[model samples]
Target: MIDDKTTPCPFLGEMVVMFCQAYPVRKPVPKHLITASNPCAGKGYKGCPFFKDIMAGLGGATGVDPTLASRDRKGVTS
Candidate 1:
């Protein structure tokens, strides 16, 4: 079962450690937050700069923005 706190960033290519695919590295980089668990594995994922950049570049994927759907899933009121 999925944990409520583990929102998982879409740019997170792998689950064996917080490997992020938002960078230009040959392989996804392992990320973390010394202050807490990585945001890539939590609701704070929406705050990632890379996530925003990638989502912005995907304008043509669909007329509707994906964040709206995410918010609905998490019951976030915009």
Candidate 2:
């Protein structure tokens, strides 16, 4: 059973990018795949396999920040 009372996954990158940072490498998740099973899409993500796969001792990392990702999409340059 999933717990509806919870915040979304922090491992999820930009709202538009739809990627999972839980993997060893960033995995691209399609918009269509954002179902109840998608922990990043809704609450109760702790039950997700990818979420559970997180290495032990890892904490306080939000992965790709949405603000930075949006800047990247806009073509940030020095």
Candidate 3:
């Protein structure tokens, strides 16, 4: 259940939590968002609060910049 408080994905135009549903499994992160292959790689689970929290921690879908989020995974920043 998405609410106004939910952040919309800047790329997909859907709620960040809904990203798991729309994307299902992880795919190659878009080049505009990331500069590496499989930068945002991960398996997605429906109705998983952990996934939601991760997305939120990454600044929600709307606020997230894949490049920046990838830093958390790779321990690198640009």
Evaluated with lDDT, which candidate comes out highest? 1
Cα lDDT of model 1 overall? Answer: 0.54
TM-score pick, better of 1 and 2:
1
Candidate 2, residue 51: CA error in Å?
2.2
Please list the C-alpha lDDT of all candidates, in the order they appear. Answer: 0.54, 0.53, 0.47
Residue range 1-78, candidate 3, lDDT tens digits? 667568766686532221222234544443455323332343333245645666776667866654456456543333
**lDDT ranking, best first:** 1, 2, 3
Ranking by TM-score: 1, 2, 3
In model 3, which residue pairs have backbone atoms overlapping below 3 Å? none
As a whole number from 0 to 100, the lDDT of residue 62 in candidate 1 is: 47
Total clashing pairs in model 2:
0
- Candidate 3 deviant stretches above 4 angstroms: 1-44, 62-71, 74-78
Worst window of 10 by summed lDDT in candidate 1:
69-78
Candidate 1's error at 40, in angstroms?
Answer: 0.9
lDDT minimum window of 10 residues, candidate 2: 69-78
